[model samples]
Target: MSLSPMTSVVVAASLAIASGAADAADYRNNPFTLTYDGAITQNLPGRVNIHPVTYKLNGLDISANVYTPPNYDPKKTYAAIVIAHPNGGVKEQTAGLYAQRLAEQGYITLAADAAYQGASGGLPRYVDKPSNRVEDIHGMADYISSYAGVDKARLGLLGICGGGGYSLKAAQTDKRFKAVATLSMFNSGRVRRNGFMDSQLSSVQARLQQASEARAQEAAGGKVLYANDVVLTDEQIAKLPFEMYRQGFEYYGKTHMHPNASAKYTLSSLLDLMSFDATNQIELINQPLLMIAGSKADSLYMSEDAFSKATGTKDKELFKIDGATHIETYWLPKYVNTAVAKLTQFYARTL
Candidate 1:
């Protein structure tokens, strides 16, 4: 059984599980490489400034961008938010947009590339295991909390797409995040193990066998195996069954394409992703929680399941953006405005 087809759509949908600014100026002028609308062209005074930063996480260098609010003064205390990008997504896309937007609202925000993906340093690249993803969220919290002007006690978190799943896991016990929220929350493990909507349930055991073989090969110094590495044409994308994947490709492939964002992962990663479930121990996340998703999103079930099981947080709320889809929440300005307004209110009241 080839590992390709099993995860081709699985990872692509996970890509659905999931910014910027520079033009004309040299890369250094806007090293952040944000791609969202109204991105910071230059760090003018009294305006949000993007800071490109790198930090060590578990012996690997992690790349991140920190956005400071207008007229930011390190001497004064401020609430900070840690934004986690979606699976196969880098910090420079929607994550950066949210970071910049949150910063404009007088909050400092940090968005980082996952350790083995994006611009972050890691070997045997594109390894997308559940543990590593959860750790990335924790690492972001660690780095952002120590930043100047960040009031550690007032920290909040916003995770997008697959990042939302990992964020739920991270916030399960990392109470440092006083408030937690997710937009277009995607359960990467659920979709990866069951194949988007459970359409591949019959092939679960077969795929597991292939993943085991891939792991054995990797351990024996054989060539590394990968999946979902194909680039799709316009006709191919339109043929995709789910609106999430159809629009996701357009967002990540063309309209908001970035070199660091990819839809592939190490095939052996299935060994770890299969047994994982984002909702496991979700009751442990006692922090105030807010989950937002498009009312029409094909991935809405994932958010609904996780939200219903979060009984530990009496303060939790599930918000749906009317007329929006999973990928639509990522870039549509109208949907983004509604989501941001709700987030701003939630964080302000909780943090």
Candidate 2:
């Protein structure tokens, strides 16, 4: 494939699973085979149009999926929302679920593949560079603003997991987004620096050392290795760090898995996430912000901490779902509905 300079090539290669791979053979040839079960699926009365488009960002061609509301009219502008998927996720992941739901609510939504991951463009696939990730959100905003039915003045962002943190970072610099929201937001840098729940702070230096070695190996023409906390086997799932990690596999590895989804990521990218900090500029985000997380989730603390640091006083709200876990918010009906309602209300009010 001849890639445009504006698109990062890394994303195209990483997000695509090899043909005949055991993990996603069914989805490779049939992208639409994955059926989504949600309120949007049941309630949407008009034809839901899914568009495959590309935009230039950071000198790379970034791919995206745009969902237009039923009865959409090019002459009439409507509120727009940009959705960013979780780490190692594509636009077809849970993001599409959220985008389709939001679109059914009369909003035009764009779900984009993050640079270096999914269908976006980047080098050394699955390399999660914080700066590039933030830029990718801005790129989506740029693309959405130009669409015929989109109201650029009323732009909002919805990011899941790592995408949430990047959304925060993007909103800090790009005032174009009038409202912002994040679900199960993961502070990639914090998790990398201190480990989950700050349990591995003592080993941070050692991890950095190993990452340095990995970088050296890559520079020496060695293939980079990818590491994911989730393990697929029954025995590995039994030893997972948290029940949520095992559950995440069920969502990302099997039932909801897309052919483009990958459990692997470039080892060198860990170095970037280890030092990246999105909360540092939370105060700069003057727009209305809604941060959602499960009260019992191990990742909830990061969202809480971010809400505390955010300077947008009256415009910011945090909702902690009582009995839910991190992965539960991804597709669980009860939690996903609550999140969608909150997000719709937040954007409707602020955007």
Candidate 3:
């Protein structure tokens, strides 16, 4: 007997889930499930603590981790930062690392899995629309602002990779984010519309047609289609042309792999992503801005472009980490330290 295509997809999805559960079991003893270096293994009294939390966002449960500074006192006020993870990334990866580091700097930091992408709640998982991503940031701000000891007026936002793009868009009108920052910003809309480095410029229309069809199929209750669903071999990953993507595989798929982290998204998401622009109406953001990128990153253009267009803020600055590639800033001690230091200063001054 032969399996139908839908059966094959369902079986594959089941296997992926089982594999993820097995991988996650390795960290079952560790409550936080954090995979970053120097992560807190236990929440000790009188020290920075990781608090697992869940809140409602658009009728879905949003899972997040709140890192509170050492000796945190709810009676006293403190600034807060909402850290948004990269596309396909969960709160347990680099986002958690940054949130922990910022917590160590005496600020409360919250990192949540994007709804539908990580451990958060949503139907038809891996839907990656820009509007949804932007709302994730706003929802974070809303939740963290009410957190004990957080000063609602001093809230800040930090977005990494694709999260950076959504953060920019979120801060454009949210206004509650007094300061906005991005690390190795990736404009999902731009890449989705024109392809990486505009390599697929000729196929924009073709891709749109496919996305339209995918949406139609979903509306008709057809089996959902996914993009970037297959895992790649190491050889294939190494052959990837862009350094950002090449090292991204090592970071996301190997060394820093997490059960919730993935690369797949609903194919119909392109219908929304293709027309979305992170920098559109960017001038509406009057808050302080800081954009950081690796000097050698191929994705540096995205940060630079957004920085230049952020004309609404006179206090904006673009900082580059010398010699660091896009993914290197995520985990490399030296680069991460430098980026965190600059971020600490920027938040101290602006938040």
Candidate 3: RMSD over Cα atoms? Answer: 5.0
Best by TM-score: 1
Q: Model 1, range 1-351, lDDT digits (tens) per residue?
A: 133445444444544222322332222334466767777877989999989999999999999999999999999999999998988788888898899999989999999999999999998999999999999999998999899999999999999999999999999989999999999999988887787777678778888888899999999999998877776566766777788988887777666767788888888998999899989999999999999999999999999999999999899999999999998898889999999999999998998
TM-score of each: 0.94, 0.87, 0.92
Best by lDDT: 1
List runs of model 3 lying over 4 Å from the truth. 1-29
| Per-candidate RMSD, Å | 3.3, 6.8, 5.0
Question: Where does candidate 1 clash, by residue pair?
Answer: 19-34, 19-35, 19-36, 19-93, 20-34, 20-35, 20-36, 21-34
Ten-residue stretch with the least lDDT total in model 2: 5-14
Best-to-worst lDDT order: 1, 3, 2
lDDT of 1: 0.86
